[model samples]
Target chain A: MHVLILGAAGMVGQKLTTALIADGGLGDQALTRLSLVDVVEPPAPAAFSGAVDRVAADLSLPGTAEQVVASRPDVIFHLAAIVSGEAEADFDKGYRINLDGTRFLFDAIRLVGDGYRPRIVFTSSIAVFGAPFPDLIPDEYFTTPLTSYGTQKAIGELLLSDYTRRGFFDGVAIRLPTICVRPGKPNKAASGFFSNIIREPLSGHEAVLPVAEDVRHWFASPRAAVSFLKHAATLDSDRIGPRRAISLPGLSCTVSDEIASLRRIGGEAVVARIRREPDPTIGRIVAGWPTNFNARRAAELGFVAETRFEEIIEAHIEDELGGRFVS
Target chain B: MHVLILGAAGMVGQKLTTALIADGGLGDQALTRLSLVDVVEPPAPAAFSGAVDRVAADLSLPGTAEQVVASRPDVIFHLAAIVSGEAEADFDKGYRINLDGTRFLFDAIRLVGDGYRPRIVFTSSIAVFGAPFPDLIPDEYFTTPLTSYGTQKAIGELLLSDYTRRGFFDGVAIRLPTICVRPGKPNKAASGFFSNIIREPLSGHEAVLPVAEDVRHWFASPRAAVSFLKHAATLDSDRIGPRRAISLPGLSCTVSDEIASLRRIGGEAVVARIRREPDPTIGRIVAGWPTNFNARRAAELGFVAETRFEEIIEAHIEDELGGRFVS
Candidate 1:
C-alpha cells in the first residue's frame, strides 16, 4: 500500500509519519511506498523499508497538485493548511493556500480519472463552528465558521464530500478538537494557553493563563488526532453515508480541570508555575470558540478519544517527555 | 441608489429587475443606475428613467468580475448559476461558474478597497441541504449537500460569511426553496416536474407527475423569492450576526397538497390534465430532498412566505397566469 502525507513537516504530520512507519502498515496493508509533501521538505523516515519520496511543494501553485498526485498514493492525508492566526492576518494568502490549494489538489485527483481514487483523509477543525451554540453541539449542528481558516476548511470539507459522492475518490473529513498538552515550544496563539499552561508547568517553567479558570473547551491529544486520521482513512464508506465530515469525540474540560490534572500528576510545585494573566483580546477570541460537542455520530462510528484531561497530559508525558517531567 | 443584478436575464433576475423598476429604488434610496450581467445579454427593464448598463458576460472568466465591479453598484444581487441538473451533469462547468465565479466577484469587491462595501445579496438554494435530516430541519441543521450544485452553493455561503466577517463586503446568502410554478418551458430536470405539474395544468396542458403523491418538498413563489432578495438586501446586518447564510422560510407541502390546491385554484378540468408517470430516477432524486423546515430564524428576522399550498397556487395564478387559469 502506498500513502501520501501533505503538510508532512508539521507536528502532527511528523508524528503520523513515525506512527505509520512504526506500525509498518495502515489498515492491515503492508506499506510499500510513502510520499511526504509540505511547503518545506519533509524529513525522511528513520527506519522505513518503503520507497520514500520526500519533496517540498506548494499546493496553491498551478501544477503542484498534479505533480504530487502523479504517483497516485492509495491513501492521502491532507493536513496542509495555514494556521488560524496566519490565515486571519493574511487574508489573500490564507484563501490562496487553504482554499485554492485544496481545490487544486481535489481537481487534480478528479482529472486523473481512470479509477485512480484514493482514500483521502482531510483534517478539518472545530473552528468550523462559531459561538452562540448549545453547550454540547450535536453532529448535525451547522458549520457557521467565524474565521477565514475555518471557512476554507469548511469549503474543503464540502468539496471532499461532493467529490467522494461523485465517485472520484473515497474521502472522509475529520473535524479535530484542539489538541491539549501540545508538545512544542509555546506560541502566542490565543488558544496556546491551553497547551502552555499544562506543558510549561509540568516541565517546571512559568506559563501565563490568558483566560478564566471556568473557561471550558474541547480537546484531544496529538496522538488521538493521528489515530482519528488513521481510523477515518480505513473506515467503511457505507457507514459515513453522504456527510463525510465527522465531528470526532473529544475530552471536554476547563482550565481548572487542567490544573487539577497537573496537580494530581506533577505535584504542587508544577501547579504553582502557572501565573494568572488575563488578556482580553485572547479572552474575546477564545470566548467565540465552541467549548463542547456531543460527537454522538463519531462515537457510534467507533471513533474514540481520551476520556479526561488527565489522560491527555499522561499521553503527553509518555510520548513527548519520555514518561518524565521536571519536579 | 445604483443596483447590479448578476443574472438579470434569468426568471428571478427578470422579476427582481421588474420589481426594482416598479418600486424605483431599493432600501428607500432613489435608483440612479442598474448594471445587469449574464452570459446572455439582459434585456433592459421597461419604463425606467435610470441609467442602464446591460452586458452579456460569463463570470467564470478571470477579468469579467473586475470589469463588472469596476462600476461598483451600491447593491449587487448575485443570482447567476447553472441549474442543478446542468451542474450535476457537467462537474467542471459547475465548479468553474458557481465556485470560481463567486470568488472572483468577491475578490473584485474586496480589492476595490477604498471603503467600498456594498450590500451583496447572494441567491443560494435549498439544494445546499441533503436528506437524512429531521422532518422539520432547523436553521442550524448542518448543510451536507448531496449534489454537486448544492456543494458549490454551500461553499459560496462559507466564503460570503467569512468575507463579510472580515469586512470585505456586507454579504447575505439566502437559501431559496424550490420556486413553485416557475414560469418557463417544461425542462427535464428532476425537480422540474414540481413546477410543471402546477404550471402546465394551469396553462391548459397535460403535465407528468414523476413521483408519488405523498412525496413532500419545500417551496415558495417567484414573487416571494424576489421579495426575499429585496428584504435580504436591506436587513440590518447586526440582526444577522456572524452567520450570514439563512434558510429562508418556505411553505412545505406534499404532491397531494399541491394537487388539492391546483384543483381549488384552476378547477377540476385543469387538475385532470395531470398524468401520473412515476420515473424511478426522478423519484429517487426527489426522495433525498428536504420536505419541511422550521425556518424560525427567517421568520423572526421578518422574512415571510406562504403558509398553505393553496396560497402558493394563488400566487402563481396572480404572478404568472395574469390572475386567470384554464378554469
Candidate 2:
C-alpha cells in the first residue's frame, strides 16, 4: 500500500510516520511506498525499506496540491494547518493557508476524476466547538467556532463530507482533543497551557499555569492521536455514513487533575515546578474552548484514548523522556 | 436607507423588492436608493422615488462582487443561489455561484475596509440540516446537510459567523424553512412539490404530490420570509453575538395537513385538482430533510411564523391569489 502524509514535518506527522514504518503497513496491506510533503522538507524514515519521497511544498500555492496528489497514494493523511494563535493574529495568512490550502487539496483530488479516490484522514480539533457549551457536548452539537482556525477546520470538515458524499473520495475527519503532555516546546496555540503545565514540570522546568485550577478541558495522548489517524484511514466508510467528521474519545480533566496526575507520576517536587500566573487573555481564549464531549459515535467506532490524565503523563514519560523525568 | 438585493429577479427577491418599495424603506429609514442585481436583469421597482439601479451580473465572476460592494448599501440582502436539484446535478456551477460567489462578495466588503461594515442579511435554508432528527430538532443541532445546496449554505454560515466575529461585516444568516405555497412555476427542487400541490390547486390547475401524505416538513410563507430578512437587517448586532446564523421559527406539518388547509382555502373543487404521483427519487430526497425544529432562539428574538398550516394557506391566498382562489 502507498501512503501520503501532508505536514509530515510536524511532531504528530513525524510520530505517525515512525509508527507506520514500525508497523510495516497500514490496515491489512504492506507499505510499499511513502510520499511525505510539508511546507518545510520532511525527513525520511531512516529504517523504512519502502520507496520514500520527501518534498517541501505549500498547499495554498497554485498547482502544489496537484503535485502532491499526482502520486495517487492509497491513503492520504492531511494534518497541515496554522495553529490557532497564529491564525487569529494573521487573518489573511490564516484564511489563505488553513482554508484555501485545504480547499485546494480537496479540489485537486476531486479533479483527478478517473475514480482516483483515496482514503483521506483529516486532523480537525475540539476548537470547532466554542464556549457556552453544555457540560458534556454530544456528538451532534452545533459547531460555533470562536477563532478563525476553528472556522477553517469547520469549513474543512464541511468540504470533506460534501466531497466524500459526491464520490470524490472516502474521507474522515477526526476532531482530536488537545494532546496532553505534548512532547515539544510550548507553542503559540491558546491551548498550549494544557500541555505546558504537564510537560514543563515533568522536565524539571518552570511552566506557567495561565487559567484557574478549576478550568477543565478535554485531552488525549499523542499516542492516541496517531492511533486515531491510523484507525480512521482504515475504518469502514459505510459505517461513518454521510457525516464524515467525528469527535474522538478523550479524557475530561482540569488543571487540578493535571497537577494530581503529575504528583502521582513525578511526585510533589516535580509538580511544584508549575508556576501560577493568571494570564487573562489566555484564560479568556481557553475559556471559550470545549471541556468535555460525549463522543459516543467514536467510542462505538473503536477509537480509544487515555482514560486517565495519569496515563497521559506516563505515556509522555515513556515516549518522550525515555521513562524518566528530569527530577 | 440604501438597500441592495443580490438576486432581485428571483421570486422571493422580486417579492422582497416590491415589499421594500411598498413600505418605502427598511426599518424606520426612508428609501434613498435601491440596488438590484441578478444574473438576469432585474426589473426596476415602479413609481419609487428612490434611485434604483438594475444590473445583470454573476457574483462568482471577478470584479462583479467588488462593483456590488462599491455602492456599500446599508443593508444587503444576499438571496442568490442555484436551487437544490440544479446544484446537485451541476456541482461546479453550484460551488462557483453558491460558495465562491458568496465568499467573493464577503471578501469585497472586507477589502473595502475603511471601517465599512454593512448589515448583511444572508438567506440560508433549512437544507443546512439533514435527517434522522428528533421530533423537534433544536436550534443547536449539528448541521449535516444532505444536499450540495445545503453544504454550500452551511459553509456560508460558517464564513458569516467568522467574518462577523472579525468585525469584517455585521452579518446574520436566517435559515429559512421550505417556503410553502411558493408562487410561480414548479422548479426542480425536491421540495417544489410541497408548494406545487398547494399553489397549482389554488391557481385552478392540477398538482402532483410526489410523496406520502405523512411526509412531514418545516415551512414558512414568502411574506414571513421577507419579514425575517427585514428583521435580520435591523436587529441589533450586539444581540446576535458571534453565532450569526439562526434557524427561523416555522410551521411543521405533514402533506395531509397541507391538503386539508388547501381544501379549506380553495374549497373541495380546487383541492380535487391535487393528483397523487409518488416519485421515489423526490421522496428519498424529501425524507432526508428536517421536519421540525425547536427554533426557540428565533422566537425569543421576536421572529415569528405561522402556527397552523391553514394560516399559511390563507397567507398564500391573500398574498399571491389576490385574496381569492378559483372555486
Candidate 3:
C-alpha cells in the first residue's frame, strides 16, 4: 500500500521513516510507494527499496495539503508541529502553524469528496493535560492545556475525531510521551533535559539536570514511539471505534530512576555525566507535567513501550548508536 | 464603563442592548459609549444619553478584528456565532466565522502591544459537551462535542482559559444553557423544539414536540442569560483563577415538566396547541444534549438561574409579554 509521511524532517519523523524503510512491509503486504513532505527538504533514504517521492513545502500554504493528498496515499502519518517553547513565546506563529496548519490539512482531505478513507495517524502530546493531575491520568481526562502548543494539539485531536466520525478519513491521534534519550543534540524544548540527561551522558558529555532528582516524567524510547506509530497505522477501525485518540504506553519514572538506569547500563562514570544545576524555569515547567498515566486503553489496543528505563536506554543505544554503547 | 457588543444585530444582542438602555446603568456604573458591530447594521437604540457607535462589518474579514480592538472598550460582550444547524450544515463557513473570527478577535487584543486588558465575557453554550453524559454533568466533565458548533465553542473556551491564565486578557467563557421560550419566530435549530413547544403554544400557534417526553434539557431564561453575562463582566478575576471558563447555572427539566409548566401557566388550551410529531433528526441531535448540570463554579461565582420551569415561563411572560400570558 502507498504511504505518505508529513513532517519527515523532524527527529520522530526521521526515526519513523527509518523504521518503515527497515520493515519494508506492513502486515503481509510490502510497501509499494512512499511519499515524504515537510517544510524543509528531508534527507534521502539509503535503504528504502520501493518507490520514494519527497516534496518540500509548508503545509499551512493553501494548496500544499491538496498536493500531498493527490497521491492517494492509503496511509498518511501527520507528525508535524511547532514545539512547546516557541509556540508559547510566539502566540500568532503558534496558532498559525500548529492550529491553522492542521485544520487546513484536515479540510483538504474532506474536500477530496471522493469518499476516500485514508488511515491518518496524527501525533498529539501529553501537553494536552494540565497540572493538579490525578495520581494516574485516565483515558477520560479532560483536555485543559496550559500552553499554546498543547491547546493546538488538543484542538487538532478534536477536529480529527469529528472528521473521522463524519467519515472523511480514518484518523488516530496518539499522544506521545516526552521521548527520553532522544538520539540527537538537545534543542530548545523546555523538556530537553528528559533526553539530555541520558543522551549527553552516554556520549561522554555532562548534561545539566535543571530539576530535582525527584522530578518525574512519562517516557518512551524513540524505538517504542516508532513502533506505536506503525501499529497505529495498521489497527482495525472496528477495534479503535469512535474515540480516535489514545495516550500511547510509556514507562513513568522519576529523574533518579533515569539516573539509576544510566548507571545500570553505562556504569557510575556515565551517571556522573549528569550535572545538577537547578534552573527554576525548567523546574516549574517540569513540575506541572504529569508523572503517571494509566494508558489502559492504549495497552488494550496492542500498543507497547519500554516498561524499564534500562530497556529504554538499550533501545536508544541500539537504534541511535548502531547497537554499541559509547564508553 | 464602555461596552462593546459583537454580533449586535443578532437576537441576544438586541435584547442585551434593550435591557442596558432600559436600565440606564450597568451594575450601578453610569452610562457611557456603546460600540455595536455585526455583519449587518445593528438596529438604532430607542434612546440613550450615552454616545453610541455602530460599525457595520464582517468580523471574519482580515484586519476587521484589529479595527474592532482599536476601540479598546472596557467591557466586551462577544455574542456572535453561526447557530448549531447552520454550522453543522456548512463546515467551511462555520470554521471561518465562528472559530477563525473568534481567534482573530482574541489575537487582536493580544497584539495591541499595550497593557490594555478588557473584561471579555464570551457566550459559550452547553453544546460544548456531548452524548453519554453522567445524567448530571459536573464542573469537570470532559468536552467531547458531537457537532462542529460544539467543537468550535470548546476550542474557543480553551483559548480563552489559556489566554486569561497568561494574563493577556481578563476573559470568562460562560457556557449558557439552551435559552427557554426564545422570543422569536421558530428557526431551524435542532434544539429549537425546546423553545418552540413553549413559545408557539403561548402565541396560539401549533408547535411540534419532536422527542419523547422523558427527554430532559438544561435551560435558562433570556433574562437569566443576560444576568449571567452582566455578572461575568463584574466578577473579580482573582476568584476565577486559572480556569476562566464555567458551566453557567441553569434549570434542568424534562419535556414532561415543560408541558406541565406550560399547562399551569397558560391552561390546557395552550397545552393542546402542542402536537406530537416525532422527528428522527431532531431526536438524534437532542439526545446528545446535556440534560442536567451541577454548574458549581457558576453558582460559586454568584451567577444564578431560575430553578423551576414555571419561573422560566414566568420570566418570558414578565420580560417579553408585558406580564401577560399571551401577547
- Candidate with more favorable, higher DockQ: 2 or 3: 2
| Location of the lowest summed lDDT over 10 successive residues in candidate 1 chain A | A182-191
* DockQ, candidate no. 2: 0.86
Full-model lDDT, candidate 1: 0.91
For residues A6-110, write the lDDT of model 2, one tens digit per residue.
999998999999999999998899999999899999987879897999999999998999999998999999999989999999999999999999999999999
Q: Distance (Å) between predicted and true CA of B38, model 1?
A: 1.0
Ten-residue stretch with the least lDDT total in model 3 chain A: A318-327
**Which clashing pairs does model 3 show?**
none
Which segments of model 1 are wrong by more than 4 Å? A187-189, B187-189
Tell me the number of clashing residue pairs for each predicted model: 1, 0, 0
Residue B171 error, candidate 3, Å? 1.4
Per-residue lDDT of candidate 3, residues B148-221 (tens digit): 88888998998898788777789999999999879988765788898999988887789999999999999999
Of the candidates numbered 2 and 3, which has the greater lDDT value? 2
For B1-327, candidate 1 gives per-residue lDDT tens digits of 999999999999999999999999887798889998999999878989989999999999999999999998899999999888888889989989998999999999999999999999999988889998798999989999988889999999999999899898999999999998788886545699999999998898999998999999999989889999999999999999899999999998889999998887778999999999989978877777899999999999999988888888888888877888876
Docking class of 2: high
In the range A117-191, model 3's lDDT, one tens digit per residue, is: 899999999998888788999887778787778888989988998899788999999999999888777766789
Q: In terms of TM-score, how similar is model 1 to the real structure?
A: 0.98
